[model samples]
Target: MNVLKCFNKGQPLPLRIKAADALRYLCSYDPVSQDIRTKITVIMAELLVLSNDNEFDLINEIMDDFVLKYAKELEPFALQLAKNLNIQFLRIAEELMNFSTTQNNDDKVSKEQLDKEYQASSILTNMNTMIITMTSEKDLTYALLGSVEPSIRFVLENCMANFISELMEILESFNYTMKCIVPEAWSIFDLVCESFDNFGFDYVLDYLQYFESIITYSFLEDGNKAGSNNDINAGQKTEEQKTSIKNEESKIISLVVKLLNEDNGENFADEDLVLFLFKLISLLVLKLGCVNF
Candidate 1:
């Protein structure tokens, strides 16, 4: 599809509507071939260029259209793409920093060119916002987890690990960006945790470190504190938010404790998995001196 022709500088509205329809079609339907995916990717690339247009209401319209139409089908793709693009943003930010340091010494590139590059980065970053919403989508999560793409499982696992590592590594540099992205990241974690039941505890254990890294990182950023109600500032956060974070902390700790306690190389029996989790939860409850589900 000639996405360039779909956009007109002189006549924008009709072309914008057509482009939005084309995008929605590309995202929602199963592609007939790899060529279609490539085409859609190119269209997405073009759409990214228009991110800064003053008349971007059509872009919002298309984003909402895709969200409504493929809330399930396109969400995992969008989520992963969003995460991947966000990682790009982090890398680009580092590049920008390096450029700023050297550009002060060089005079070859003009200010306008540097400004264009910065603007391009900002546009890509804003395009990533749509991805954050997809990650938080509840129905989409359920659909992605339930998807049985046996052929793509290995690819998906690798992509997930790489994406998670990239996100964790540069999280400090992009704290505010991550703050906006965290809820969706947690939604992903929730799905990964659920995978324990279907895929087995061992599978979940394989990725638990990444999960803990996110928790620890967020906790550190949020003042490296957990459940310290005694501190005056700690009381400022809502009890629900605190409890939720605590629950996640408890879950991770419980899983780690189970792995350590059952240090035998064999996977735990299904019954054992349940009993282990129950005991761990009980121990945490007792240690905290509170009973809350």
Candidate 2:
């Protein structure tokens, strides 16, 4: 309990960080009771809210260790951690946007400006690390996904195109089984489709590539396994799962139709992208059944 007091607002950052490190070590090595570990986890989550940008990396290390060692204990705090993370992402997005405007106006970039850019980028890197770490745990995956959905939408809507790949990478981190089990899995795709107008054709194509991979893995591979197996109902999906996947497929097709109808193909005038779209449609038809749009 004394160690937890070091995280008081009056405490220095280094001291707080040291206290966090010490607690992490004790949680991992000491024969602590479940209640003590749960208390420590709650304290650590609160510390994240109080942490500044400079301390993100150190705090993330401690949080990651806590997640690894005490995932079940940390499950109750998933939503809290996710909300804190989204706040960080938004703060960094604003910083990156301001830095971009400053860079655009300045003819010669100063060392100070470069350092600011690097610091902003590092904060994002650490946030991504935390996201991947948290989402890898099955119990926390859906809760985190649902909590961070707004952040996902905000990033896509706001002109953060460069960071879209990072979002896609995070989505890709979920395995096939989780996708089938988690009803909120399709929320990301729904948000992407909603934000299509904000993206350029190149980014659209990047998103399409990701969609194709997901469709192939979730539908095609599973279909093949079912086809070869004697017991078709061995791993059958529940009716609710079937409905959820169907809704997802419809959303994807709707997005494709919207893309095709844009400017009567003028927007997709690039032959290569057009071909890729057709190929994706064909894949969908083959694996997921007829593509209406």
Candidate 3:
């Protein structure tokens, strides 16, 4: 408790590490009481919210280790921890997964690659560990997929469907398809809505606008990805990849159509939504070549 208090009250890095190490030792070696375990979980969850580099790295290490080894004993407090921290961990993971795409062979490797890549590469590198915890321990089979952000999900629904076709057309010059390990968009849209229930119709409006950014990044006609060493290659498009992408997009379009059909303009009733709506419409016209209605 003293260690935790000192750490939480803003101890120096060494002190914080010392205290955190002590906590780790107690949780692993000593048979801490249930109350202590509960308290520890709450602290760990809170540290994730803190999201400082040191704190997040330490707590992620602790929970990732403890959650699996002591799964049977740790469920109650783990749930509280997961609930309190909620989606933040997943967001970190998604950001990490998406991080790979931001660079390509053509991009000059920076001296600060370690710091720049650490955030995402850490999760991607440790994914096997995370998958084991998620599947065997936490019972969330597709939690990573479930946790992918709305913007990325939008890209997946479009890019992955026409993935091969789109890649052949837009990214054939590119050597890297760093956008792997994605999930279907339709399933995630429901969850996205659930996740942002507090924001109501405005969330939908914002996301539609966010889709425009994806449009700009994805559909370049010159076949030059800003960060990639894309070499020309059309023969790489596999029939199976195309088929899978089509199926995923087909489902996503259902929801898209539903939203389009449902919008009789009242949902944009908020004065604030007009700017977003107009921007989105312009993006659709400029990027997608949609006929202006």
RMSD per candidate (Å) reads: 18.1, 7.4, 17.8
Q: Which runs of model 3 end up more than 4 angstroms from their true locations? A: 33-36, 52-59, 70-112, 124-130, 134-139, 142-144, 149-293
TM-score for each predicted model, relative to the true structure = 0.30, 0.57, 0.37
Best of the candidates, TM-score: 2
Query: Candidate 1 local accuracy as lDDT?
Result: 0.43
Task: Compute the lDDT for candidate 3.
Answer: 0.42
Candidate 1 local lDDT, 193-276, one digit each (tens): 554434445344344334434443344225334433322224345667666666665665655565557657555555555554
Better of 2 and 3 by lDDT: 2
In model 2, state the lDDT of residue 261: 74
- Any residue pairs clashing in model 1, and if so which? none
lDDT of 3 by residue, 15-81 (tens): 7656665666676544553445556556555455544354244445655555555544444444344
Clash pairs detected, candidate 2 = none
Q: Candidate 2's residue-wise lDDT over 162-260, tens digit each? A: 667666655555433244323355565666665555665666555665676566645524433223222322366666766656666666667667667
Candidates' lDDT values, in order?
0.43, 0.60, 0.42
TM-score attained by model 1: 0.30
Clashes of 2: 0
